[model samples]
Target: MTEAPPDRRRAGISILSKLLAMLLGVSLLSALVAGIVGYRNGTDSLRAAAIERMIEVRESRAREIEAYMDSLRHTIILDSRGIAAQAIPELHDAFRELDEEPVPASEQAAVRDYYEQTFVPELEGRQGGEADVGALLPTSDAAWHLQASYTAADPDWDVRLATNDAGDGSAWSAANAKYHDFFRETVEQKGYEDILLLDDEGNVVYSAYKGVDLGTNVLTGPHSGGALQDVFEQAERATSVDTMAISDLERYTPSEGRPTLFAASPVGSGGQASGVLVYQVPMDEIDGIMTSGGAWEKTGLGRTGETYLVGPDHLMRSVSRGLLEDPEEYRDQVVANGTPRETADRQVAVTGSVLLQPVESFAVDESLRGRSGTGVSTDYRGHETLGAWMPLDIPGLQWVLVAELDTSEAFEPVRDFTRNLLISVAVLVLLVSLASLLLAQVFVRPVRHLVSGVREVAAGNLDARVAATSRDEFGELAGAFNEMARSLRTKADLLDEQQGEYERLLHTLMPEAVARRYQDGEETIAESHSDVTVVYAEIVGLDDLTRDMSSDEELETVNLLVRGFDEAAERLGVEKVRTLRSGYLASCGLVVPRVDSARRSVEFVREMQRVVAAFDAQHDAALRLRAGLDTGTVTSGLVGRQNVVYDLWGDAVNLAFSLPRANDRPGVFVSAAVHDRLRDQYSFREAGTVESGTGGSSTGPEPVWELEEDSRG
Candidate 1:
């Protein structure tokens, strides 16, 4: 340059440039620190919450399994108890009620007639009634001979007399016939496999299965063969023991198939073992329960989660995967060959604790002992797993029920969530930093122009104005500030003449409290307090009204009605919380407390009734309003962002909505609590107590008091 720069211009450039550089550096540093801290804290909190949620999920699954097993046990015990108590006694009573009394010769003919009519037809394919038919006949009667000749001879004579000894040969035979029929029809009809009468020596005296005869010793039969004899002998020897006899499928497996689950209980009489009632449930059927999906799937358990019953011998008796899968092969390959029976039994006998843990080779050790609960992380088939173990306290068998789940599969969602969260936090922090830096630069430039313009105006330059080059928020702010400065300069000339007009405009636009909040940049919600009743009123004629109007007209009319209702409520110092044109839900008494909420509610109803009456009178149509009221604590506050409005919530609000429908008086209904609150304050006619859907017993109907006001009085 040919000439040197002016000293003043150089000083201004040096000062303003240094100030802008310092501000930008400080802002960037602060943003970096805040963004880093926020991201770290948020990530840590989310991780902790995720872990807590997983723990809750695990505990919930454990509790559900425990409850399910408990329920199963309870149901089975109750079923068995019923069979012992009610069902058995009822069957015995039915036998006693059968007629066995002897009749006189005159009445005997009538008895014969009655027997032929009622009993003969039912015994057609059954036993031939030979022994009792001839003796029960009335020899002098012609009709009795016809009945006696048609009856067949009895097949079972000896067994009849041995069981019961109360009548003549013929009458005894008849009783035995009836008893046999009852046994087959009642017990067998209900799905009992075999009803066998056994001697103390375990000999089958009587059996539903005829192949197994009177002299056959059950102890020698295939049913009680092998190690089962020891179980049977133990049951017979121990008079106090009611333990069930359990057998392994391996012991009874036929060459054709796998072994089945067979159990037997000894029926004791007078402190002695009379017989053993053996029940054989095919392994497939028992496995069906052990693996049903309905029981486990409903509890949020997946197919990979399994429940299996392991016997004292470490053999799997039943397994359920909550899916359709065969467990027999799995049991044979994994359980049967895994552990020795003697070791498992010793562990169970010594500790009496159920075992639950993941195992590699199923080696028995002291590690398997204890009644206390614990979890183990281990490998199963090279896959890491989480196993929950519980002991099943079956009367005669020491068994463990273990539920195992694959850990990776179970916790995959949590892992993925954490990974995604970290990525999201990093991305969001980067975006915010970039956006803030841009905003800072944009705002700083505009602020510089504003500061320069203010200085120029202070120097008596009345025409000075800021140039807002963009239409964004900052640009709008700059334009407004420039307009304000220009107005201020003009106002200096006419300040006294405009003061009254400015004050009037300010008062009309905002109240003093609201204006203060706006000046301080605070968001405020309008609040009111008065001792006035609140009411919730619903219109009942909207369905009919909607049918007569187009959809657009219906919506418009509903909106107008809601506005009208809100206006009426506001005029009475009652806050209108919300309005649903179709359902007609409206609320009041939220902003203030009333001496009696019920009375306030009634007044609200009166006002609504008047409004609706006026509207109906003008239109020549009838309209109905239902109102509910309750007096209690409530909190009212503004809710939502874009379309913000006051809302009320509390038991009072709920009761108000509920009361009108309960009143069912065609106009308004109120609960008893509401009526009691308002009865002295308002002239209400009692419509007596009625059943209400709200506010009553947990299971029983609620009692609601109905009320109507006397308009004339």
Candidate 2:
């Protein structure tokens, strides 16, 4: 037992451990798989959201870019042929001479002197507010698109030629000062880089952000190869002054070679073409729109997301996100795109800051060809990136908007989600494992207790009882086990009592030896005995007394008298064989022969007479009792099925009953066979022999005798 407990506990623990392990293993595996799948799904969802955000940013920038261009075009037309389009005669003559290509050096020197002495002073002398300058303002009917060449073909290109050198009070000076503020304030409020008015011959008549551009003919100047030729040619062919034309994106040396677009519209007065209004709209304004919406923040693109426009030539038209926030990364990105590192640094310095240098990527290439879609690909910086691209809907501008970001930055939220998911799954699995182990221990306790109790019962210890620890199946099992043990004990007691009763009944029914023979499975019960005494005793008036008595009283009186006889017979060493209707039949030495069998029968008969006489006296009634005895060869046997009787048979039993006569009194009457056997042991009165009559089964008459106890004894 010392070793058994440890071994059994180990076995129990091992079983519980295995069960817990299986359950937890399956649960954790399922949870892990589900978590991984959920993580992947969540990641994909974030990616989709990022791409959708990129598309929105791209669309928003496109709209703002279009709006910015429209504002510049509108401002250009309002000012042209109006405030800054005055073609003074002296100004026209001066511009005409200066517009000559490859003129004499002296002629160019004279034109420069004229601009320093006349144009510079008159242009700076404008003063005060001019609220009623409407008369000076040209009507919309003024024709600006009728001129043919890069010459002073219309007066609107003429700048007011300075003459008197009187300073700040002249009409030209007043108008110069008044509209100077107009151009400057337009640039401030409307975000145009420059607003220029050109003559019909494409001469720069007036300039905002005034530089060398004023008083020069753009067709023959350093910027001649730019959109000036196209604008003049288109204006020459226009049928109305409202005719507008736009040039493709390009760099103009007049604007320091930054990317620019020229939108030119003709100014008109009374349907006569007078001048062309050109809005020197810089691409930088579009760049500002591209960066307006905080796309990275709204779209969850975080650090590296950008929205930019690209021309049909596949060059970026807008700035990059990294250029603004992370110039170092932007430098590396542009250097990788064929820019010399020193050149990138020089260019960034020359621009007074870094810029998203132009570089074509997969998205740019696709958008340039009018294709539109979204995907993951290497970006302009050669990093794996996600992007969405679509063409802009503005007319005459084959431009596209693209939104892009590095994949790592775009899917940043997904990464964080996955990390948290991993931590949560690990913790949950741990908790489940621990919980399973504890539950296993709790569950196994009841089973172990039950096993121990069953083992005790197997070892025959019925007292070994299991404690019902909980209201569960184990408790029910313990209760059932206790009931089984009790039932076994009760059955054992019942078996012992039943066995005792069986033996007693068997003994009461027959002699011990005969009963033993029956218990041994003997089918027939019979025995032959020589000189066995058979006696029949009767209550003399039992039938007559029963007629006068109630049923229960008659039965009780008979029972009392019969029981007294049986007691006396038992005391005299005789067996009471059968009793019927107050008649008692007894045998002496029927099972085993005895020399005193007849004498014992005579004593039993004397006892029966005394018992009957005493019963009559005790009850205060005269009840006759008689006995007849015969001593002869008799056969004894058991009869009946449900209840059996042991009695003497053959001649001896018949002669005993025949010995009684109708005239006989209440005394023992015996056949001569009994007198012959018991006359010496006790005295008897000899009676005359009687012939066999209807009352007897005997073949011949037998002498009878009256029985008495021996007085000498």
Candidate 3:
């Protein structure tokens, strides 16, 4: 090389600068190419993974919803074939007799006032329109009487409307007393909003919850042309028990205009379809399935992800998770997205989105067209989202399930990866030709250790931890990752403990067999026993004694007596059905049949007498127990939706309750059937006779017998 001036050398570009330029160019070029290629592949993979996850979740939810509909169909068919067939004849007869009985003008006026003041206003408030109070008024004498006594006369009619008795001593009241518990329990246990029994004439013969629809004739009544009437007519035309009619979810004025779905099946006996059994499907269940009980995260639906049902009308069938998680945000989003402010406000007010929030989206349109796929589309909230959609397989329901996640959340990891890769590329380009080996040794080893630990944690080894050998960013990341794994482990343990507690509480609330049936997804628990004994014990003075005591004192006294009764009944092999105020109902052979049911029931009653006697002597209170024992065929099962109770119904239970009140004195009495069963082993004398044709099978005076003072097994 010739000696040259520094200015001339610089101007000509030095060899060292040339080599540096080439190295920088190559390094920057390679880094840029790698970053672009890696970003494209990672984003494509992430998008595909997100779509696939959405599809999987959508399919799973759809299948579950379809199975739930199938279960409802199966349940309706089975329940219709059960008490509906046997109960219709007696209920119809009683209904007819009540029609013949004259309705007092005062009672009819009370019913009319109830509609005007209570029912029509509530219906209008829920359905969002005016209602004709006169149109909904009972048109039949029986309707007037039943509604007057059961629906209007009840002071807490809105609260405890499921109560079956009015003590009005009418033929319909008698019939209601006989069969109402069975139907009421059915509604509760099966999670039915209500259960209605309709005769072949479309007359709503009985209502489980004693709503305004209790005695209305669906064919000619105010609700004649509605979904109830349609489903009733379809079910009436059914030739077999398997044939059923399912109504779409609609606003039902009778249920306060809540979105209601009805499933109806023919009720038949002896090859004759005599009536229709209708079940109001509960909204909570469908919503629970869609929202996974509001645990969207557990279903892999991260923040801003949710699944919901869209009906044929483009209205939501299930409640929106947005409404539940963030009501104010939901309101603002919905109002901004073409939903009227008033409508959105109403949905928030109702704490529901069903049949109100309109979803005019491409996903819903495609789903309605019966085509299922995954894509990016604008959601109901007007946010661009990754969605998977499918039409539900449930019959008579043109509903589609759409699972969606906001694109912002779905692409978050890709965004992070791109950003992190860009930074890494810039660093690599700058340092590639300078101290490259040193950088690899210092940074690459710690990154590899961190990556290995991340892989271990990703593979479910939560205990896998890397040592933070140096106080660098990589070491801090390792420490953070380890903490995250520990937190996840703690949360998993908490979830397990919560699940165990839930299982324990379930078992405590229900009998072992019933609890297992519930676990196995059996909703209704009614069963019939051909031969059984029921004991009804009334603590005559407890109410009077408790009247003077404070609420806590009264509760303590009641608990003490009930606890003692429960202990004695358990020891004597008697299953206590439930307690009503001061009355305790128990039976043998109700849950587990026993051959010596009558004897066990009698012994149980004697123990109850002793329990009351001990309390009277100890507290110097006149707590007398008058118990009645009866042996006959009866139906028994678990009832109620939230606070479940075991109940017994039939001629046997009715007669057992009637025996104690047959006489003025408080003593242990047995039904004629019970006395006949136990007379040989225990002493008995004729107590008195109670008219038996009220609602039971007996047509004449039935003799009541008293258990002698010295009676023993």
Candidate 4:
């Protein structure tokens, strides 16, 4: 407590000041070190979480797109089956007849003006250049008339599909009137932009939307080298109902240069392809899925986040969210990012970015190489973003899906943490610990829930679902995972349905035992039975009865009679092998040997006669039933790979088929072998002889016996 000298007092004060300075330095250093480490770790974790979220979104979107494409394919294929069998021949004849019908000069001028004035101007507006109207003009008088009726007649583009007739009394117009609404309804209901039907010669016989491509030959038209033509050619070569073709997204001039994708399938029945059915896929459906209906935030794609598709040419196939939400900003960014100002302007003018924006980056390159994962790269807008990319599994199109989020938004939390830690040095440790705990709750817990749900689903529990406990990216991921599982369940059920259909089809084609052998991968399926009996029956006078009927009426009548025969055969325990145009071949004891195979064959023949008699009586027509039965050793087997058929062959089968032809009269006939077995149960009389058509047979003519009037027991 004593006062010291001035110099000693100043030295003591200096030492005290030095001690305070050292303490301040250590505090500042600790705060600085803590902020740097926290910021680094937080940013890394945030980036990883963002990338994982993007990957989830990318995979979900890819699956949706593939499912959509597959649905479209199935729709086209199912519609193509038997669609053109009768329509093609009728349209082809009508188209030919139109050639003989002259078109007035006024009609010709109208069609030309439609292409030169209405179509070309709109096309040039979208394409930013002139189009050759002459190349798109119809070259044939038939084409000219049809186009005048369908394309040029309707001045309103919206109502073009509703105009079935153009007041031109032409055969082509009549046919169009008959089928226009059906095709138009298909387009509207299925969300297709357009539907085109082409004849076997590649003539565009029908167009639902009446575009400029209608009435022109796709094989050799001006648009012949484009994607539509390629799909058409590929579809025309398809010989089965399941075979189809698809084209990449391209700007279709006929659609006013809009980005369009095309799918095609052959249209016919009976194992023959007679025409091609083409569908123009709407671009909006694809864009809607990629953009999530413009509610990106709801889908957990925060502001500046988007999903898009890139084709093999590296051009965008879906619309950009920036272009949709804010065109000016998108245009400016793209222009600044090396895109030509004119191109950016065009994208903005069209209100779309498809086919105009190019995404050249590591993500795209890797996706095109068939790799899938997440990474850091520059996006199409030239902003640094965390991206997830994968090749789409859609068939026949080489495309990729990319999900991206700008780094500024993804690292925003990290920045906030750093800023707060720097602002309040006293609370540095508390802030770091809080941020770490928050991040773990936000990302790790949700990820664990998702992993558990995924494991459950993978273990065959499709009903497993993760709780969408919050409105965050993790919640969105949970929803997407649930949707994927639901899709899988739906697909599994669909597979089961298809498997059942395949089984039914197989059984319809061959016996159950033979089908089992075929399913087991047997190369050759044949069975020999010595005691089998075959009954070959023909509906006599059917052709004469159906001579005056329309093709549809004839088919209906034949189907009705055949169905009745089938029901009767099933009731009598007879196996139906096959049915020809007017004949049915059935057998008994071939699959399960029976001592009364001859009796069963005779019973089947009697039942078939009853079916024909009922039909004749109902239609007030004169028709007869002729059938023959035989008992002998026979060989039964399936033939062909793609178009499979079941048949039996032997002396017995040959005699059963030939005996009905040999007897000029209409009745039930039996060979001697069958008569020998059934004579005790059924009364029989000698009807005559059936000489083998192969006349050099060493065995003489076989005797044929006719059943008595009261044959049924």
What residue runs in model 4 are displaced by over 4 Å at the alpha carbon?
A: 1-41, 82-85, 424-713
TM-score of each: 0.45, 0.50, 0.60, 0.56
RMSD of each: 15.3, 51.0, 22.7, 29.4
Per-residue lDDT tens digits for candidate 3, residues 386-442, read 999989888777999999999999888888888899899878876886744454345
- What local lDDT score does residue 378 receive in model 3, on the 0 to 100 scale? 97
Better of 2 and 3 by lDDT: 3
Each candidate: what lDDT?
0.48, 0.66, 0.84, 0.84
lDDT of 4 by residue, 1-713 (tens): 78865664433444434554555566567877876787788778876777778888898898889999989988888888755456666788888898777889988999998888788888898788878888778877778888787788765766898887877787777878887778888888888899988888888888888888877877787667788888888887776857779999988877888988999988888877878888899998999899888889888789889999999998999999999888999998988888889989999999988889988888999999999988878987899988889999888999999998898887677677767766776675456555545544454342776888989988999888888887888788888998999998999899999989999998988889999998899868888889888999888898998899999999999899889988987887888999887898989998888888888788888888888888878989788889988888899998787776788988888889888876688999998888888788898888988785344564778889999869655
Tens-place lDDT digits, model 1, residues 313-333: 544555334213443333333
> Which digits, one per residue and each the tens of the lDDT, describe model 2 over residues 28-143?
98987999799889988998898887777677766787786676556666666576455322234434543443344443444445444543343333211222222211111111
* Ordering by TM-score: 3, 4, 2, 1
Q: CA shift at 170, candidate 3, in angstroms?
A: 3.0
Question: What TM-score, to 2 decimals, does candidate 4 have?
Answer: 0.56
